[model samples]
Target chain A: MTLQDYLPCLYALLACAGFAVMFEIKKPMFILLASATGMVSWLVFLLLHDIGSEVARYFLATMVAALFAETFARLMKAPATIFLVIGIVPLVPGGGLYYAMDALIGGNYALFAERGLDTAAFAAAIAAGVSVVTSIVRMAMTGRMNRRERETKKEE
Target chain B: MRAKQVERCLNFCCETGRQLIKNGAEIYRVEEAAKRMLSAFGYSDAEVFAIPSCIIINIHDGERNFTKNVRILRTGSNFDRLDSLNALSRKVAAKELSIEAAEAELHEIMGRKGYPAWISYLGYGFAAFFFTLFWGGHALDAAIAFFCGLLVKAAMGQMVRLKANVFFIHICASMLLVTVPVLLTALGVHIIHTDKIVIGAIMLLVPGIAITNVMRDVIIGDFITAVSKLAEVLIIALAIAIGIAIPFGILRALTGVM
Candidate 1:
């Protein structure tokens, strides 16, 4: 809704760019696309702030990132994992996991439980989201390939 | 097929699969690429199996069956290697390259060097800086995390070069990262958010993207690979948690404030 709210998206973009570099993404164009996927995923998470649940928000954000990755892979003729790896960095609950561990060590059982469960939920949601989209894409590609083979056989 | 031809085809397919897995490609992708390359070489009776750590290929050449396996000692995300390997496999599958030429290409891809160390260090620094800010840390905290990130990467690089196990490497890297923020906070830099800095730096060690890969493996019915990868993710998490707690305990005992 405001300029301030968009700051995290920029941070996500730059952070993903840094990771892309470390991961040896040689092409500048790919680095930009992968980093933009991160920004877009964060934006989606923010846009759906008032969603049904936090897990749902994470799931949808990861789905959008997965879609972006698949599209970019097809368009650029690269592996989708390259983009997917960098794209969802903003949504991974690395902070939550750290805080959960911190809480556990501090002997705060309640905070530890809360943060730990929340972090696992976020990870699972993102995992499910990416898997669902990738499975669909894989199946669709195979189906098309099969149809083409059948058509070629008929022509022969 | 001649014995020599079968051996060459087997070597090429196995090498392709091995490189793909090493560079963090999906199990299905590696298996499919190997099979495609085999079919292109007219080995329709080939059998290829790949897991996270090994690849086995069996080929029949009318008179004999040839089998070979490659053990993957290490695996990491190297997109450049994966991209080149993927392209190489596609070319092989398209029948665009001779066996000798494709082997040469594989050799070149395998021997290709990664980005220089300084670039990776800078990448880690900027990633930590921006991640700290993303998680609501102050500008000073981010600056502190940038250097901490560089330190973590340098330390981890040395430990890796020393042939430490992944678990030990993660433990030491997280402990190393936690020490910086904890030491800073103890030095009365009350402005630094110790947790944020530690989180930002430790992000370098966390297998966040690996979670998605594990899920993809499960979706594709690679239950064994998925379980092994999930175990890896859990092990790294436990190591990091232990790493962070060790620093906190020692520092708290010494300074009574961390």
Candidate 2:
């Protein structure tokens, strides 16, 4: 990762760590977790995918975030949602949403659609990355969740 | 998948939300603690809501219901701003000290100027601008995106009525609200302002909040609530995206990007 890419990752890590503190993270646990997320994310960008493309880089980084969240949640015995919430920040389709709105406000339909599509894709990726990983993990743990929730509901 | 989490509390227990300030109890901690106290007293069966500003309780008996404002008070803690202010607020709310007495002490704490919370908001807002600036969008556009996040949270204050965890509310509201704007923006109806204003303001809405809660809960080993809150936040964001996109698409087809 060039200094530029590394810089964003650094910011993302700091943001994640800041979140840990802001939300009252316990001592020292979040340091290693967030570091792992940043390290893994960079590795994914560098080795797993083509960083030549901006969108691709973002997509991979976000996926790595999801993976990090899933792994952390599993290891720590917490919900993966923390990773979802924090990781989604840097990758949030903020630009897509904003540019899309700008295009709309400016009465530029094509620009709006293009940006809007980009936003939806990112949003979905976030949702899917979180929901899919957590569910898969949980499914592995409690194979009885689906049928159990239903039977439990019936008894209620 | 069920987004809005509502479960019966042990009683109207005030959750004294504490921040890791390394020294006295922070605002969140004090509020949470007071709520638990009120809940135990039966003045409330459920903590209606609590913030740095005010807390509302579900008056279980509905008899001794007195006031409904977020009143600040002070205490003689023999020390700094946080302690004295929190002590005063707690004592008054719990009725250990009368409002008049608390008010007298508050004079000193209120004199201190500046708040640190806005700094975090500013950080998130700037982050939004950077996130969006690369998309060939301008500064104002990013500002709108950030604030859009705030608006979503404020709006959700009325929409989803959970009170235990403000972090959960923030995440849920942000993801849900952003989904529509993002989708609509994608669809070419971006009528909002800056990514900063639109998205940054709502950074408060992002589930980054739940990270700490989830971590603490995991560390303290309260996995059930942690997982439940996490799942709810994610699902809500997904739902919000659907809420914005489907309607946006239909509207676009009918009237074009208006």
Candidate 3:
């Protein structure tokens, strides 16, 4: 990949780190990890966008970010939202949402509808991606607990 | 006397849940944490219900059941408080902390100051700069966005201090964001893509945390909290859109340029 391809990832890292600071994420290590998560997710999104539909690109990127956030939360002994918020920053459709509003205000109905739908689609894709990963993790956790309980009963 | 003791335990549990919800903890997590803490304190029949804006905790101590309701008026996310509160709950669940000790620790965490105002202001500038770059803006656009971010942050801080409503604050911030770049371009400076600069600066107001929590809450079947938070997100988005639209519309009409 060209150096230009790496620029987005670098910017994502800086943006996430800035957000971590603004949100008062006290630990420097957490901030660094969160920023790295953002960078990886943005990189993945950029890579996938070249080959997939916009919705699929967002879904895959969000899944990667959410899984990373969940793993980091477990390893760091903190809430997953802390990491997830920063990780998904690079993927959130902030620009599209702004453009949708801009179009509406400028009386361009066609552009408004287009941008609005795009923004909504991206939001839905992000939600679906996070939900899928979270459910899988939850199921795994419960299954492990159930197996442990069954083993204890057998031992008794 | 026994009734008084049950009341105290219920109050403590409810207060803990309230703090969690106020600090933007998910509904399921808040309820689970409060329940675990109460059970550890010997209130084995305790039930905790939490939403984005309110928490209701019920504790039964054989002869009498106590239900306490706490209304959360304001909500913001601070990961440090979330971590400490989660740790405090774990300690309680492990039977390592008494009710009084837990209360004391919670108070200390509440009183702890976050990073100073200046650091967050600097964060606005940095976020604007990087987001501009991410949006494919050149170095000049990033620089302009950085200054615009500082201006927006200062304006927001002033509005907050004046106790202005959040919707109005958003409107004003967006207006300032678009107006700054527009005026700069009019002043003979070659700004490449003012739209990217506006987008980067607007990132400061996007409800990222609320959206994330809303999805998680929906997956966990906390529909009440999820729906309410979704409404909040939509309102904020609408406010932001209105904010941006009004200024650009007025400017286009006045100057015959967009």
Which tens-of-lDDT digit does each residue in A1-156 have in candidate 2? Answer: 456545555545654554443333333664447545744554455454444655656566666777777778667644344345555566555446545755765568999889888876765555455444554565665677678888999999
Residue pairs in clash, model 1:
none
In model 2, which regions exceed 4 Å deviation?
A35-61, A143-156, B1-258
Pick the winner on DockQ between candidates 2 and 3.
3
By lDDT, the candidates rank as 1, 3, 2
Q: Which of candidates 1 and 2 is the stronger one according to lDDT?
A: 1
Worst 10 residues of 2 chain B by lDDT: B1-10
Best by lDDT: 1
Q: Model 2: per-residue lDDT, tens digit, B1-258?
A: 111111112121222222111122323444455554454444445444443234444544433333233322211111124333444545555667433454455554456543255544544444444444433345566556555534553455455444435434444455454555555566675555324344444444444444333433443334554575467456644444443344344555766753
Q: Considering the true interface contacts (CA pairs under 8 Å between chains A and B), give the fraction that model 3 also has.
A: 0.81
Say which prediction, candidate 1 or candidate 2, comes out ahead on TM-score: 1
Tell me the TM-score of chain B in each candidate.
Answer: 0.96, 0.38, 0.94
Query: Candidate 3 — which pairs collide?
Result: none
The digit string of per-residue lDDT tens for model 1 on B185-232 reads 777878789888887777788786567689888988999999999999
Determine the TM-score of chain B of model 2.
0.38
Worst 10 residues of 3 chain B by lDDT: B183-192
lDDT of 3 at B57: 85
